[model samples]
Target: MVWRPTLPTKDNNVRLEVRKTYKLYIGGAFPRSESGRSYVVNDAKGKFLANASQASRKDARDAVVAARKAFGGWSGKTAYNRGQVLYRIAEVMEGRHEQFTLEVAASEGLSASKARAVVDASIDRWVWYAGWADKLAQVVGSSNPVAGPYFDFSLPEATGVVAVLAPQDSSLLGLTSVIAPAIVSGNTVVAVSSYERPLPAVTLGEMMATSDLPGGVVNLLTGSASEIGPWLASHLDVNAIDLCGISDAEEARELEALAAENLKRVRRPAAEDWSESPGMSRLTQYLELKTVWHPIGV
Candidate 1:
């Protein structure tokens, strides 16, 4: 006797895990690449993961526009208010702990415990930078005694739109370390995520969107930085470029030259461990010293 195969019904319940499709985070929205192209992501062992939007020159341009638009309101916000928003981001990120741990483990070929440590470090990094929001100026600025009867003060100010090439090695921790410093000091960012492992960055962007942070304050793109970095380095509206993602001396030098056209502040990549305490250097890197003079005999 032949037996017939039957499809599963309510009597035989089955569930399927839903997979996620990653997209670029621009202006607080997840948008497909303007070029309408995408590349597949894989685990450390070459297993399929998902497709990530492959950002192009046009996408870079759009991110710059978004960053520029956000500069005014973000920079204008009180330092205390900015600190609150940053703390909110840490809260949201904490709620997504399991998700980040799983992704980081797969992308970086680490065990669960190791990945959790990275995730924890990233969240704490945000908190550390948040505390500096209200105190950065005090630590970085000073009053000077001028020869004349005038008071002179030098204060640290946001340098406007900054483009960051996030470190590719430590996808989560390094990315957090690079991003928090720039935005914590009131500058908005357009960052390039890791070319091979970008899922964690997209998840961070999601947390930022819901954390009461304003749109475009931190735009993230997932693609080849080599393809997009030149446009960002040369962008006239961008006031600075963080070259932490670049390791090659020749490439870093070339981007530095491009940034010189507009005299953009360029921070080259340093060989350091992201898991260690970052100190105050990152806070000072993207800041500009603005000196003001006031009459003493008023």
Candidate 2:
């Protein structure tokens, strides 16, 4: 039998590199696709990066189950506790900054400098959203002035499970932008990562597990949006859908229709600079406002 020689580097020494396989982040564990299917992931230069799980309808269903089971505990936590947990995510992300920069560079075709900028912004975004958790209600809710002798007030509540389609173009930043807002308000998320660039998202999921985020607080799926988008939109248990990553009008239209079946709160995709200040718009969208009145005669 003929033996094969090891590949040599420029220095003439044999070299081997171990590549990482990307997988679905559900219930705080990385699992292969339930269908046992995977798709090749290529970098900006069209080089093979890794194999990403091709999540199936059953995977989406499982994610919904995880998110629903997590919602009660997550939303029940004190706002201050939630804020601390969100901040821990930022801390973990900070420790993994180099990994994110490299992945963003390969995925987006950005130079090292530009990729670093995006990574920095993404981390800062978590901090921004983390602060909002404890303060959003105070900023958005208000006491109403009524004509009668009654005290009227309005307050916000966390919507149930939210399904997120993360932005496809700006992988890291857009992913962080959409996710932080939804979960900051105490809504658990089942997010679909950037279809074209899912490495950073998978790594972020790993970070989430170690950062004090409970299992199922945030579940991530990587695969064809077209396949999972409709399933998520139509899932009866999902209370909302953020269509931020769906670029095609027809696709968004179809998903919107599916979401309408349950009157789900939908955030339709639109052109915008994700790096800009996100403001409170995203936070408000996932929130449910309840107004109440009490007789003042007592």
Candidate 3:
């Protein structure tokens, strides 16, 4: 049974519970969105225990500002330092199993056990991505050759601000897939969550906010995907778009076209295979082909 600390009576229960409200976590601090908006998060029983931000375009801009502010610090850190920070996130996720299972159950409308599974899987996903931070450079990257090389090489660099359309289903894993690739390769992302599955996204945000991830590395926004998906596609600030969860070919095409305006890296949706495939492939989708050149001297 979920623990209820002392069954609040008809008296102070009202006062004590009133002090609690789920708030959006931004920039490593839990603060009400500057827009000051909230929407209800309903449980499977259709009861509301908390509210989530109706994150606005203003919120998006604020997130971009935060990401920009944090970028130098995060991206400047040594790759191993970045790896350690990313791994710390998984450590934080480890200690919050009960809370994750309960909140995920409420948000996704799944059975408690199933919610537990998703939460556990999500934590493992972070560990998977964490392990990739320092290693992706070595694995997906390679030295370049020239006619007379003095030593030339290129490494994958961040694609700048990326916009993510989180999965329509499998909320947690889907978001993890999208965000992991972007951040692991050094890109920053502003994610539009699955409208129905936004709860876990914010929960993941809560973990990141507290887990030593520089703020804005992964900004989570929950809203009309159809509405914002295209907007983000054409957003001047966005350098790449990952349309992984968009199953509709027409919509995907439309979004891809929008991304073309700025030549943003576009990753089209792929066939779903839960069996086994290297998830590191997410890093390759947005990786840029930068080439360094040097002339051989006599």
Candidate 4:
């Protein structure tokens, strides 16, 4: 007798999953690339996952405009208030813990438990940066001694519209490490997510939208770093750039040359252990020191 495949039954059913269209996060809203372009994103196993917006040079320019517009307000907020907002972001991320773990696992090809650990560490890293928002002034700023009857002081201030390149390998954790430090110090940012593993960064943009953070304080673009990096590095309005995600040495050198035209603060890429302690370097890199002199009586 020949065996045949079983027929569908009422108790068994197949449902189609709703796939998400990953778009660019700009000015606290999700918008498709103005270029009307998109690229296919794949899972670690090389299976089709979804489509991500391929941001263009125009998108990079728009992101810079948004960051510049939001700088004054975000930097003006009290340090304690900024700390509270950062902490709130951690709370929201905790609520979406499972989703982040799933995305990280697919993006990095890690086991479920390891992804969970990374997610947990990302949340903790946010909290750690939150705690520093209020304390950074005390730690980095100082009262200077002068021979005259005047008081001299040096204080750290936000560097204004910073552009960041999120790390390629450690998507979530490295992304968190770079972003938290910059924003905790009140600098607005336009960040380019990893080209290969961008899902976690898109998820992060969602959390930022729900949290107490203001629009345009952090703009995320999902596309090629090579395409976006040069524009941001050379943009006249941009104040600084973190080149942590640029893997090509030649490309990095070229970008640095462009940044020099505007005298932009360039943070060169280096081998980083994302899981280890992130000291004050990232926080201080995007900050400017302001010195003041005042009469002792005044």
Candidate 4 lDDT score at position 140: 97
Q: How close is candidate 1 to the true structure, as a TM-score?
A: 0.95
Query: What ranking of all candidate models by TM-score puts the best one first?
Result: 4, 1, 2, 3
Clashing pairs in 3: none
lDDT of 3: 0.73
Tens digits of per-residue lDDT, candidate 4, 185-289, equal: 999999999999999999999989999999999999999999999999999999999999998899999999999998999999999999999998999998999
**Per-residue lDDT of 1-298 in model 3, one digit per residue for the tens?**
7877666678657444453455555556666656787777666677865667676666666666666666667667777777787778778877877877776777677898888877777777777777788887788677876667467877877667778887777677667767876787677777878766577777788888788788778788765567668877887778888887687999999999999999998888777653243466677776776767756674
Better of 2 and 3 by lDDT: 2
Task: Using TM-score as the measure, name the better of candidate 3 and candidate 4.
Answer: 4
RMSD of each: 3.3, 3.5, 5.0, 4.8
Tell me the spans in candidate 2 whose CA falls farther than 4 Å from its real position: 1-16, 295-297
Write candidate 2's Cα lDDT for 217-267 as tens digits: 899999988889999999999999999889999999999999999999999
TM-score of model 2 (CA atoms): 0.93
User: Which ten contiguous residues of candidate 2 have the minimum total lDDT?
Assistant: 11-20
Best by lDDT: 4
Q: Report the C-alpha lDDT of model 1 over 147-210, residue by residue, as the tens digit.
A: 9988999999999999999998889999999999999888999999998999999899888888
* 3 against 4, candidate with superior lDDT: 4
